[model samples]
Target: MYQCEHGGVVRLKLAVDPDLGPLAAELSSLARGAGLDAVGITGAEPFGSTRRHLEQRKAAGLHGGMHFTYGDPARSTDPDRALPGARALVVGARSYRRAAPAPPRGNGVYGQVARYSWSDHYGPLRDGLGVVARHLEANGWQARVLVDDNAMVDREAAHRAGLGWYGKNTALLLPGKGSWFVLGSVVTDAPLPPTTASAAGGCGSCARCLPACPTGALVEPGVLDARRCLAWLLQAPGTFPIDLRPALGGRIYGCDDCQEVCPPNRTEDRRHPPPPAGDEDEPWVELVRLLERTDAELLAHLGRWYIPRRQPRYLRRNALVALGNVGDGGDGRVVRALVDGLAAGDPLLRAHAVWAAARLGRGDLVAGLAASETDPEVRTELAAAGLTG
Candidate 1:
């Protein structure tokens, strides 16, 4: 049984054409030559399981207003939505996991960023997928390259392609390689042969990932409540939830706790060689510097990510929380950050600053802020934190 993207299960009849074997072989070679770590093919069937999961979770409010695949599951789960005549999907994986890089020298307060965000993994993955798409085009088949695209469910494509299995964390884990790889695919009208087999999963009784979450975002095996997820919340607009602030800790963007605790990922991490530039290449952002940058400067640095409506305040919002958690209240730099946050234009930023100021136990700072605070929200923050004069 092969999965098609549009709410239907279809078998990719291998006997449709004998030449598919050679074509598949050539495509895989092209992908690897172009720098992809893994490549495999599967039918463009709608990922029924993925669709069901998304629908169920959204209905339960577990999606937390997340629209990615949930905005319209039927479209995202069906490969055909990406291309009308799609017959097969060629999934590719690229490794973004690098050896831990040391923090840049001289920092007041440092916050952690997920490994995937440290560099643009999708750029290389897209380039590699393009190589195969060109090959298919040369062979007279319509091919569309999709990586990090909202129109497709890439992990389902990879799973059906035999490249990996679903780990408890909902990540597609490549056997022996773990969940450190980024996945993408080429959906085409060509009826390529599906891979003979998928990588058998090694996860047995292990459930370490569930408990590894700081906020228990992973509610059950492979199921996540996006409302509680720090990664999504960071990119999510508006105020950072007060209850979850402590769990957010020093993470400015993305949370890798589940993957960090996975046995397979850890084992492979130990054996694999570190990234070329070491930890220095990793973009471990300095918390205090966030508020210092102008909108243009901040955009130039992190334009790659999905900021809340492309606004810089969301980035500053996350940094404010990080600064509150890891920053030294005694440091003059931290004092300036708190002060600047109080003067910010956005109510969201102002509200978050209130939380951060309270977290740092900057009572004197908050007391001074109380008198001048006009925003009802900020006033509530001051009173709640006992900063009321």
Candidate 2:
């Protein structure tokens, strides 16, 4: 017997019967019918190799202070930690792929958003997994849905379920389907038969994604130095690194350079074109407007995103860096945004704004402010830009 999170005890039973295979098939169908693009089952064994990899990488500092799966590899890799007496995992993937929207033509400089974040893809993925979990519960099995949660390593679970192989970019690539899907799992005590095989193909000799990384974050196949990854950097706390700011281009959140160059992803796009994005998709954000938003407004707009400590200033800091890369110095609105950033109380924002001002050739705006700047970090930025001696 195992205790569930809701304070209920469930007797653990191995459903070792002829019906296990058919049950797995039925669950798969249920998952697909509920909107999952891909679904498979695997045992709820601890991901031993994945735990070792996480530990080794974390020890070597490849995790770059990231504390997701790396934070507690043992607990994350073991499905039992999520649900005691867990016997199987029903993994599901939902495709978030969509045609890129045309770049908006506007007065304000726009910041590029990564594809996965164009909308809340995880919500749909979770909804699909919830369907499977509900079915298990209705069958007198204890099931818990895990999506984008640190309690489980969903990718390894997907791979173990024969969903896909790990791409050199570290994304799980499904056969003929590419890596444009978000993954989730339903951990349950039901003894379901595992998938018979893994994804049919592997990355083979292709290494295109390694060099395609804007910041060389891949380091090598299947390994990422999160310190240099733009996606992780955007979500990391404190100031964005100075050296990586330029390569950041106009990206305010996440980066897709690696996946954008993957041959399989490109092939998938050409073969089965995704539907064009609708007006609801936010592929771009106006930098000036983002900078101008109040703390409440900013949080309301991007509350779903993983902002460090849920602070809105990180958004502004990212916007300032993007503005520096793409904003026209001659534009009054651009200048006004930078001025507001430079004068803002947050030293982090002021520093990034200083860099943006200098990048836009508007050092005159920062020269006067640097003399009275109290923050050492802001002064350092002014000094680096030659705005101060």
Candidate 3:
């Protein structure tokens, strides 16, 4: 028999031909052997709450330029949409808890990347999931697998599979193991052992994650307003809402304040090496240097860590703001980079540069960039920054 809880249905039944348990167990063993902390089976169904939240995130324009998975709700939520006969989902989580270097002092000059992004999660996680999918398919089960790329609400699947519970930050936090893990799933026709109920949250009225968000993006327990989130800010393209830029501080990559304050996360064992002391590859960049990077150089550097899917203009804009925040305007190098980026196309970058130059009391530089500027919109922005040549 099966049960429906949390607005979804669950069933426990034998796989086809009733001889599937041994093979499924073997598949589970292989996944664990591959460095995954946990693997469990869940019944296929739409993750209702997660889907609704995702829709709300998009509708509120909180998704910014991150529209790839936002375009398809059914395909993202319903496993059946991925595989017609998919009756079960095999969910897995790989722990990535590594110690981080202490953040640099004062101006928040060197912000940290989120733990999951600290390593190349996709290739290894997908490889392991694919291996499990193959094992199931070899046993005549139709299987399809995916990691963060798909339209799936992976955190909910992890919870459903008894791997973890959603913390106040909306991340899946496994007991004693923390939330620094990457999640993946395989959908298939095989009926496997249903996972036990996941542990209820251990947060217990803790508000550590809430106050730590520089932009107050947490909103409330288990709810997030991505509009104000620094995580979204770094990846957002096009025009940034004026209100969000200052809150970004100097974070050039992603935000980690919330996780850094969490008790469990603080104690977790970090297996990866510490980040570099100073290099082009360090997590946060001096806004001035980022603006200096050519499009090709920026692409090469960011592609090593981030997926450069959005328009490059947003990243450059962010770099400009970071420069302003760090008070790096006195440097001739930064001034030169701003001049170069201003000279280049991309009205978005020009506008941000105007704002940055004004904040740095460099109206003269703005005037200089505006002198040869042919774009009417850019001239308007320069004028708005109190620059006229």
Candidate 4:
């Protein structure tokens, strides 16, 4: 309690009790037992450095129409913007690093998904963070859980919490462990002990991740141009860019080349046994089946992904490109898909179909399509293929 003298009258100001007394250890212990691999705390001040970086990159056109925290850096960086009167953030990290699954058993054209998308890693991560948040709530503090959410800059919080340092690839690298973790946090009003200093440099001059990009997406250390990023390109709606289409290879979802080539990741994997697999998890999806899935079916399967406008055609668009990259040029299904897409009503599908068919040396099927196609976009696509009919 404090006394304030005003006009010769003494008034007492009662101090609010900080409920987190002696509870930090319990929070960390509960988080670890709840399945989180790394847990730490930090003050919930606005992430100034991160906000400036976001604003600067966005102004430079490096954001490439991509908007997450890039949408509004000021709001995203401030914990108060997410929750009023927030004082501390309890950050959590869970490893999604798993040995690559065995290649497809049968003869089927398939597209590889990034290891992170192999399953719902965020679900378990959220559960662990929930335990931490509830623990704070069970006491007398107001707490909120955020994971893979735009509410806060999770990596900055994690870094401040001494969880790890940012690798050249812009991923957080755990001390001995690699950058194979999914991050999240619990924002609370409790006055928890915050980590003093961030982890020191782990990537001493290793530039392997820089040249590892097949599409040259990594413009520099710790900076990425989303336009050139294959992961973002796949999620971006509209036609896949012509020049980068071939570089896509058989990647249907996210790209993991940078992480795969990271020396730390390779070393970390060798030390642990492969993570178990399940029928629900898919490291790769059959190209033909993906193209054939209906909107409902696509949602049922890939809804967790960041699909463009929640439409199935976008997935079909990506599958079509992957098919052109790896599908047998003469496979009946491949031929049929190309022909069907060429004859379809959607100009986006029709345009990509023209490219895929011609790419597969099925120039013969395009002649009839060129004659029947009336959409100016489809005509332009055919003209590009040298099909005048």
Instruction: Indicate the TM-score of model 2.
Output: 0.95
Model 3, residue 186: displacement in angstroms? 1.2
lDDT of 2 at 222: 92
Which model, 2 or 4, shows the larger lDDT? Answer: 2
| Ten-residue stretch with the least lDDT total in model 2 | 10-19
Model 2: per-residue lDDT, tens digit, 1-389? 45799999766576433456877788899989989999988899899999999999999998888887888999999999999988999999999899998779867689999989888989988988898898888877889999999999999999999999999999999999899899999999888888866638799999999999989999989999999999999999998999999999999898988988999999999999998987678999998999888889998998878899999999999999999999999999999998998889889999999999999999999867877987899988988999984
lDDT of 4 by residue, 15-122 (tens): 223334468879999999999999988888899989999999999998888877788899889998887888888999998877677878887889999888988999
Best-to-worst TM-score order: 2, 1, 4, 3
TM-score for each predicted model, relative to the true structure: 0.93, 0.95, 0.83, 0.93
Can you give the lDDT of residue 142 in candidate 1? Answer: 83
lDDT digits (tens) for residues 73-105 of candidate 3: 667888878888677789999866555556556
Clashing pairs in 3: 76-151, 97-270, 98-270, 99-270
Off by more than 4 A, model 3: 1-19, 56-69, 102-112, 269-289, 304-310, 369-389
lDDT of 2 at 98: 95
> If both were scored by TM-score, which would come out higher, candidate 2 or candidate 4?
2
> lDDT value for candidate 3?
0.72
Give the local distance difference test score of model 2.
0.90
Kindly list the per-residue Cα lDDT of model 1 for residues 138-179, writing each as its tens digit.
977789999888888888888888898888888889988899
